[model samples]
Target chain A: MSSAALVELRDVVVGYGELPILTGVDLRIDTGEIVSVIGGSGSGKSTLLRAMVGLLEPAAGAVCLFGQDLYATRPRSRGRLLSRVGVLFQSDALFSSMSVLDNVMFPGRKLTDLPDAVIQELALIELARLGVADLAERMPQEISGGQAKRVALARANVLAPELVFCDEPTSSLDPINAAVLGREFTRLRDDQGSTVILVTHDMEMVRTLSDRTVVLAAGGICAVGTPATLERSEDLDVQALFHGEPTRESQESKRA
Target chain B: MDVRLDAIRPRSLLHELEIHARTRPAVLRLDLSALRQIDSTGVATLRAVTRRLRRSGVAVELHGATPEVMRVLAETPEPDPPKHPPEPGVLESLGRSCFAWWSGLLTLADMVIEAMQGAAGAVVGRRTFAWRDVVEQLELMGADALPIAATMSFLLGLVLDFQTWVQMHYYGTESVVLEFVGIGMARGFAPFIVAILLASRTAPAIAAQLSTMEMRQENDVLRVMGISPVRHLVVPRLFAITLVTPALSLIATASGILGGLLVTVWLDPHWMAAFETMLREMTLGDLWLGTVKSVLFGWVIGLASAFTGLHSGYGALSIGIAATRAAVASILFVMIVDSIVTTLWTMAQ
Candidate 1:
């Protein structure tokens, strides 16, 4: 991984009204690395990601994306900064009014000067990679939840953004498509040097694909290291987390 | 609490178990050691018996299952509890409903008030409206609505005139029907009909669209991208609907008068005499009153629809419920405000 930071959180505090879920969260994400953020449900995984992605500004401290403070900058400059980032929200926020293919092509067309044909071709390839190519012509409402998640994932990566934030990209996916997503993220990093911030509970994906995993619990990051390193750590909570979430089969595979 | 299960008996075998379990044993154990044969019906009956007992706070245990019975039990999932939890008591339910209704009203009021602030902010800040969306909404709420409003108002006028003429013709005062039709259309019927038509047609559609977008979190994406969903979505439609409602009411008023004119031309042989009588009886205040009512109804429909939509719960079912609430609340509030306005105007006079 490159030493230059793509995103930095400095003593960040964020939460809903009148209560803080994450406090004094400090971390750095570098270029060309896939970082998986794993935590139990309601453990502030999505909240931390939201603060980093410019949706919820921190109550205190700083969130620096591409070396610029996301909230402290001018609105026009913030737009320019956000244009380089892509996000797949937990709800799979595909454009309900547009066909699936149009949704995948949206960011490329809006953020870049890419030709329409090129954008369409790129969108098709991304969709095929995620096993949602056939559903491209369908509207968001017509597809199943898994299909919508795949379509949303394809759209997020279509722009080959400098930074990508995906929340539970494989939660609704079957094993086959989820594996495809793992490979797609690898391709995104190897081919485009894109940095990915994956917030998910999919331990299998973390085991296979992440360069580093950030274990969030008790209001801040408890452990941050390679998955294998964290798996064998001395801390009881970290070992229990790695052991608890994955299946018995994954545990056997890890031993082997 | 070990209850022996020997064989599959027919009627009331499970019934006896259900009745026996009514004493609410802390634990009921079924020992299947002596069971030889069991069919699908027997398994289903046993499942239902276990389910009812469990629901009533009994702990059911199956033991001593032979290999065959074990295989049968493995294939079938343990009976699940009811999907919906039990309802609260009557008073509790009523209290819950009242609290929910009041809370929902408060939330809706906050959203609409914030939107009004945004609308005012846009004008003061000199921001440009999304003209394309505004034009499309204007076409939908005003121009496309024109024919329906005209036809409905015209038919209403025709019925009123014909009914009045039947009695007035005998008194040789048939022209007096024109006075009633003219004043009624300009002051009351035209505005009320147009308000109802737009409320039923456009308000629900707006709520559905906004709620769908909300469920999908599309606005959150826009917010993340440094754009306001209000600027991109809400203000444009509000601008158009607010501009169109009064204009459509004016057109509806003219169409209703024309319908009365058709009746006059068809009945008495002299068209000029009856037309002159209707014109002389009409006042500009009547037209202005209808316009004012249309303006009030327009804002009520727009704000109420937006309120339900922005506060809609997540998912398809909730979106549908919000749209229905939009139509009903808009119409109810329109009449309440109309009555208030009319009564105030009458008292002032």
Candidate 2:
């Protein structure tokens, strides 16, 4: 991997209203690294991803992508830069009114100057690649949850973005599909040289596909290291996260 | 060695930095002493340029910065100019309202064309048009609306006859009440009353349904698939409302005339023969005008309702707000269109 950082978050504090969900988070991700950010519910895993993707602006600090501050740039320039980044929402966020084939073709049609035939062919190839070519004709409503996830994956990678943010991509999938998605993530990093930031609770995904694991606790990164290294973390919060135990703070809150 | 950094503002700071970075000086010294104010964009530009220059093996140094500029540079970019939403002046608000109204009219025209195309497509064996959905909407907007519309029309006719009958009877022109009731009920009252009722009834229902779909992200799904929700959803409902409302208006006209006939029988026991003769004198042109008005009113209700629903903001509260807005807008549009049509028709006669 190159020494240049693809993404850097410097003391980012994100929130809605007054209560900050992520506070003073500083992290740097190198190009072509698959980093899994794991946290319990409301630990701001998705918030971190949203901030990095420019969907949410941080209350303080900065998010720099390719040395350009993502939120600081003008909207038009930021939009242009965002074309190089892909985001897979937790809900899949598939356009409900369109066929799966058209859903996959959406980003390509928006971002590229390709002919309709070429766009369609590329979309078909992506669907085929994800083993969902046969379901392309079906509407998003017609497809199963797992099929929708695959279609969403196809759409995200259709542009062959340099960076991809996947939010709980494997959360609703079956074990088989989850495993396939894990492999797809590896393939994306290996073949396309895409830097991936996956926000998920699925530790098996982290163990299999991630080059590094970031554990978020109390609105900040509690630990960041290899999955195996994080498993042996001395911090109680970090240990509790990996072990799936309720942290002392959570227990106290629960009792109160 | 000295690199002069120019005025740093949010607008063009990033572009300026990119231009500066391309020169690739061996030793870059940024003179920021002249910088009066710097936003977050400016700070980000400086950091990015510094990083880019460092990568190219150029030495970067900041020579002089005003304390204010230095402080801005130290902190995360000035919290992006506290995004004060512009409070539009009266003229600005009027201009915006005019633009919105014009845009709405254009959208309604487009929706009508799309609906016609869908109807034509269905007729020509293209299943892309949703005939089943149209039928469903027809049942909801037309069949389900029959009872309340009929009752309202009947009550309107009875009230009109009762109010005017005593005056006509005193003038010994009781027979003129038949022509008054017939023309008024057929050309004016029935269609107008039915339209207002539907505006309150069907328009809100359509808006609520569509707003729910929007909140649920179903509309977003359609957008992502490159499918126009207006074409898919609005077209069917528009067609159904347009085709069914005239039929309902015809029913209302009959019910209203019957209400007048019943009132005449009650007021004067021997006036049934005179009422029938006067009713038979009613013109076909009057009935046609009512039908035309009802159809136009239906179009207004459907277009306004669907437009408000499709553009609704997120949340359950927004759905109710959208429905209310749709009803209000539809009624307003119907009144405007009705006045214009009535004026034109009267002028031509």
Candidate 3:
């Protein structure tokens, strides 16, 4: 891949209230790379994603997308920049009243000047790609959890954004569906040349999809390398994450 | 060579740059003195063009950029603004509130139009209306409310008759008691009381139902599906209320007249003469005016309840708050409509 950084986080410090989640963190992601951010609960994996997506402002430092500081831009300009980015929320966050097809079509209808027929055709194509075109007319509530996730993925990727952020995409899926989603992510990168940042706990997913893995611990990046390298990481926290071992701090806290 | 740039809109600037780069000058200097504003897109376009040109072994330099353009290009991060905006001054707040109320009213009016169109479509057999939903709401807002409405109207009539009888007895005008009760129950008490009862009872129920839908994001689903929630969820309830409320009011009027008759008969053995006098004094105009007012009251209550419910915030607590607001707003609207209708009818008389 070319040495072009699609996303750059320079000493980004993000927190809620006074409690810091991410402190002085630096990272760069190149175009067409699938990066996985893996950590235990409350390690601020989601917080980092939110900060990168402009949903939450960092307490300090900068998150630059395509060489422009995201939060430094005017609100309107920020919104326009955000159109080139797609996010798959943990909850799926599908509009419950709309049918699956309509949910997939929603972003395109809002952001593009495409005609209704063309938009519909595109939405159907996405649904067919995800193998859920038969469930297109089904309401979000009517679909199974896995189906909902797939539908949400289709919706997020429908805009064909340059970057896609997937938050726990495989957390609630069955093994078969999880495998399907992993393949889909790989397909997204290969076909669309889109960079993906996946936040997940499923180590199997990390092994299957991520070109690189970032291990977050103690409000900072503990290690970042390929999944194979991370599997062999010497850092105790990184080892604890990969091997499911309790680090000294966590064990001490448990005793306390 | 200097190339001047003007009106560098972010949306189109990238495309414009590609067209400019087609000439492939060995040395390109962009003069931005004419640029009044530069957005994030404009900045991004410049960066992309610079990178692309650098790869192609062409020299590029930006010159004559104004301070504003320079600031954006520098990507100097500003301190984040306060999370919550500063509170507006009192007058400004008032103006904002008035504008919000006016905007809300316009939205409600628009929803009402959409609902009416949907209802009309149902009537003309062009669209399918949820007959089952309308029936369910009718049972809830109309049939279930009958007992309380009847009891309240009966007590109201008894009190009116007793109070009027005592005063008339002092003047030896006790014979007018039946006429006074009949005219008062038909013209004012029955429709007004029934409307207030429904506003308190049915409005909250509808509001809670819709607010729960909102909380669950069901309303959002409808919006995403390109279906109007007002037309789908609200029109049925509005129609049911509009059709059933007048019937309930008529029942209230009958129960009230019966209660007054019972009181008059108990007070005097020769109550038949008073009954005949009341019949002679009662007019169709009075009955029709009360019916019209009841209909208007029903429409106002339904509209108010649905409006508050559909706009409710997320969660169970928000649903409860929305229900309370809907009830209070519905009652207030009913009273206002009642007052205006009564005044207009009185003036016509």
Candidate 4:
């Protein structure tokens, strides 16, 4: 990863059919940075992720990947660009018919001309890194919800994409599992030098994993700062989401 | 404290057995009347309790269980479910493609034979399948299809009526316009033409949409959510098409009749009398036969369109091709089936 910015969305406006979801949103991801995007549900968080990967084209703005205009490229070439951007969808979008191993290998097979044995070997290696190697043979139905999330993470990392985008990755996971994912996400940035864009409501995850955080509310950026800066900032909406959600101390005291 | 009869047998054998141990300290006198109905499930429940208690080095004694319950425990055993987890062998996975799959090869050998055998099962089974998805698709395909098909068919009738009168007027046979309209628009041409129109306009559209959704793994999403794609996706379209095709065909028939009436009534005042006379001259079988053809046409249109949609490949371009091929295939199938039925019905007379 060079010092250059990996992805840049300049004055981006995106829409679905006639309805505009994102309006003139400007954002950038530099190489090897962990940036967490926090927003309320349906606030164009997922839409921004889609636009970054060129899945949803920005209607009136430009999305440039590694300094190349996404729209100028042919659709096939754009897919090549997208292949380098790994996405972990909000729903853990795993293929139900394929086993854990097969799902991981799907992207690798698409992005590389490696032999079957090589692909399988690489897939298993990634699964092991995600701590889901034992679940390679298990069907998606057989795995627990947390286990399925890990498998999806393994699949997203299969191609070793330079930019990884996660949508509410820790939402449904238990504390232990969520912590494990947060640690791994930090390691991805520190070890592989990969830039990560995490869209989540989990405030603790934002504090622990992200170096920089952007708060989105009512469909626009509310604030931008480090975790400490955010905690001390006099932003009511940000403070409400961060501390307003029942903290562990409150929950345990309530139990008592 | 006494154990209730209802507590002896529970919906979940495991939960019931575990809950029983919880109440053991409180319930000194337990009613075990429900234990008599304890078959394998009940014995297993007891065995689970015994195993847990034994592991904890606790000795448990039960007095209320009858001799019949003791006998059932001695005889009843739990058998593990068969180890048939769907591990589609490496060979089977490799055989998943059309060029490589055994079923695909067989499908190629006798297309008609396979279709006939598969049709009844697929149609009936898919009637309840993907029903929600099919309903969603009907809104997309059938409801939308009506406007385009009706517009084309209506214009087609008008064109045919105008063109026919121009040629027949050269022979001074303007009064015979109803004779041409009744036979031309009712007997074979009306149903066949309407079927062809729907096949072209709607069938391919269904195929393309399904193929695109398939590419997006929308079908997989439904499957993961434990939704039956056929029940949720196919049935509604099948039902909708079954419903809409006839209404559309009737519209086409009405348009053709009205077009013919306009041409003849304007050209000559004797057109109504000629049409009534022609109605008497033509056999009632012609009218009945046309209605029968319409039903067959509806079935063919609905079935072929849905089948093509369901089997479409996982690419945007492939969806377009599937839609086109579906239309072509449906048109051909409808014509062939209609031709065969016509020949058979006419020969039986």
Top of the candidates by TM-score:
1
Q: lDDT per residue, candidate 4, A106-206, as tens digits?
A: 76654577887999999999888778899999998899878888888887777778888888899889997787788778888999888888998888888
What TM-score goes with each of the models? 0.73, 0.53, 0.53, 0.46
Each candidate's chain B TM-score?
Answer: 0.80, 0.71, 0.74, 0.57
List pairs with backbone clashes in candidate 2: A95-B221, A96-B221, A96-B222, A97-B221, A97-B222, B40-B77
Candidate 2's C-alpha runs over 4 A off are A1-89, A92-256, B1-119
- Residue B145 of model 1 has an lDDT of 87
- In order, the first chain's TM-score in every candidate is 0.90, 0.93, 0.93, 0.89
Top-scoring candidate (DockQ) = 1
Q: List iRMS for all predictions.
A: 2.8, 6.4, 7.8, 10.2
What is the fnat of model 3 with respect to the true interface contacts? 0.02
Task: Give the DockQ (C-alpha) for candidate 1.
Answer: 0.39
Give the CA lDDT, 0 to 100, for residue A56 in model 3: 73
For B1-349, candidate 4 gives per-residue lDDT tens digits of: 4444455453554464456666545333435665656766666666666567555554545557778987886677666536886877877777665445566445434433434444455566633233444466557655766666656655665677677778887998766666777666667766777788778877777676666656755554343222334544554556666666666666666667766666667766787786786577667677667777877776676666656666676565778778887888888889888889889987998
The digit string of per-residue lDDT tens for model 2 on B145-228 reads 899899988888888887788888998877768668878888978999889989999999989888888886556544433345
lDDT of 3 by residue, A1-256 (tens): 5554789999999998778998999999989999999998999999998788876789899998887898898655776777788778777778765689988987777567788789889999988888899999999889899998899989888888899988899987899888888988998899999999999999988987899999999989989999999886667787777778857786565457
Residue lDDT tens for model 2, A14-67:
987678998989999988899999988999998888788776789999998888
**What DockQ class does candidate 1 belong to?**
acceptable
lDDT scores in order: 0.84, 0.83, 0.84, 0.70
Give candidate 4 misplaced runs (Cα > 4 Å): A1-4, A245-256, B1-349
Tens digits of per-residue lDDT for model 1 on B119-233?
7766675433446677988998888889999999998888888888888999999877888888889888899999999889888988888898888788777666555566567
